[model samples]
Target: MNASAPQQSNSTPLCYSINSPPFTYNHPIASAYYSSIFTLLGLPSNLIAFIVLIKSFKEARSRSRSFFLIFLGGLVVTDFMGLLVTGCITVSFHITHFNWRNLDPHCHFCNFMGMSMVFYGLCPLMLGAAMAVERFTGINCPFTRTSSQTKGRPISMVLLVWFTAGCVALLPLMGVGGYHIQKPGSWCFFLISYKGNDQIFSLIFSVVGLTSIAVSFLLNTVSVVTLIRVCCGQDRTQRRRDHEVEMMVQLILIMVIASICWCPLLIFIAQTVLSEADLQVRYLLLWLRFATWNQILDPWVYILFRRSVLRRISPRSDWSRSSIMTLYPTLRETIRRLTSSSLELGEMDEMGKSNVTAPPTLKP
Candidate 1:
């Protein structure tokens, strides 16, 4: 019996290991439903945003464009790409309800998904931070403004963002951080299951990414408050300030929406890392759904809040700054303000009524 007992115990463990069902919280129906919704809704909104951003870029050639216009355009481009890659792949996986890992245990598809998701997701956070810093500096140190608002500067910044994100995404393949198929098996991300340097890398990445986003959100909030106070001031002469205020409001709204979509998931990941707890499939899916929802919401957010500086300059194919000046009083005021702040009210009237060339204050 003693000899038989040892054999039985070993067999029991083997049987349990082989027969036990794996933990899975796959809500395939929900995932498919949301993925469809995201595709249907997100595509059109992002396309419109792309058109608007392109128009803004075209406008930059003739007007004194701000870095904000460039930064916002870059952001839209990134989001658009993200929606295309992540959204489509996710929809495919969810609709089929198939775990690719079952066929290919290494989950190359998941790795690819993770790489694209991390790259595009992190880009916005970093870009948002950059935009906030630029706006803060511009508001506080307008005199120190250099030619940094030029197209070259923004292009350089965008390149840097892409380069940084590319490096981060590659780390998983290099073995520091890693990607794995999340349960429901349709999605993938930084592998929380890895230990040592891999875990440390993931933790540090989360902390830095979340911190950058939080700081951007906070800075934007402060900027909005300051602009609100400025806008409420009785001085009607600060119409340029009013325009600035309007643009800042749009930016603030975007930041807030981004925070809503991302902060909870980030917080959850941070807690999971610190606590060293097993990640639940349901929690991950819920948060991930929220994150993906941002892709759908991003462009629409810009459109809903569009006004003044952030508005589409013109729909006309022959649109030009001179033509825009004729169409928008704000543009005329902005051009006149740039040419000469000391221009009398009568001078503004004359400029408004005439075909005045847009003075370079085309602050995008």
Candidate 2:
């Protein structure tokens, strides 16, 4: 009876331990499910968006709009590559369950993946913020705009964002930060538990992500309001609407979906660093899952929020600007006002014809 007691305890060690089941991608069936979901959700949407972007680019009339389409093209490319690159590595890891220390003795693989995760994650948020700024300038600051809206500027800015993300992603390799195999160990990212450099790195990632979201929200709100005013104004001279309103609708949806899916992870990163709290493995996994949703849903913002889609769904749309129904209901009222104005114009012309005063002048 005394010898019956087992030498090993039933309780499992912490998830931080290398090669531990809790820390590694040990479940094959679950990994397969994850791989399928990401592939199906992210791949087609991005490809379709790419095709649509090319056609739209050719159709773009204004210089600013052409630049904006270029930005959208860059975003589509980022999302497509982000999905392809990260998905391949993740699926391979889960399928193989390779030992990180054995497979990557020099930590090169770990570091590269860590950097890729950060680079891809930051790019979309940064791009969203950049698009918002471009739209705001096109709407509110068109006359005062500088040379930044030049043909090369949009492409240059895209490259700059990619370069900046790459630099930050490499900071861990430069000793400013570090990356570790995070839970289910297939992926590498910043872990908040480490004290000096890792903590700083986590804070930096969080700050940059949060700031991009903030800037996007502010600028997008202002731009949307400006567009709403133009579409709703009583001034008859303001009949010509900004064709960029449809693009603005897409931008707003992208920002909103991104904020919804990413804010939790970004906030979690900040809280874990600040509090030095016990790592909540479940919470981290949950938030990480949330972040992936942004990639899956982002391309659809462009695909679905178009003027063509709006016209197909609505009862009728004589006004192009009426397609902004994805963001606000106030635009429905504007559509009614425009339709009413057309009827009123017809009635006013008839009244003018009836009030002809030819007989009065002859009698005098």
Candidate 2 per-residue lDDT over residues 1-364, each given as its tens digit: 1111211342322122233333533444335567658867898989999999899889887787788888989999998888888788888876787776667654567767877889999999999999998889888887876755477988998999999999988886666666667767777776575477768888999999999999999999999899887766555556355467777878888999899999999999899889988777768777877888888898888888777676687736554443434345676676777879988998999999999866645554
Q: Model 2: residues >4 Å from true position, as ranges? A: 1-31, 145-149, 315-364
Candidate 1 lDDT for residue 338: 55
Cα RMSD (Å) per model?
Answer: 12.5, 9.0
Clash pairs of candidate 1?
64-362, 66-364
Give per-residue CA lDDT, model 1, range 37-136, as digits (tens): 8778887888898787677667654222446677777888888888888778778876665546354443466667888978988888788887787777
Judge candidate 2 against the unseen true structure and give its global Cα lDDT, from 0 to 1.
Answer: 0.78
Candidate 1 overall lDDT versus native: 0.66
lDDT of each: 0.66, 0.78
Residue pair clashes in candidate 2: none
The number of the candidate with the highest TM-score is 2
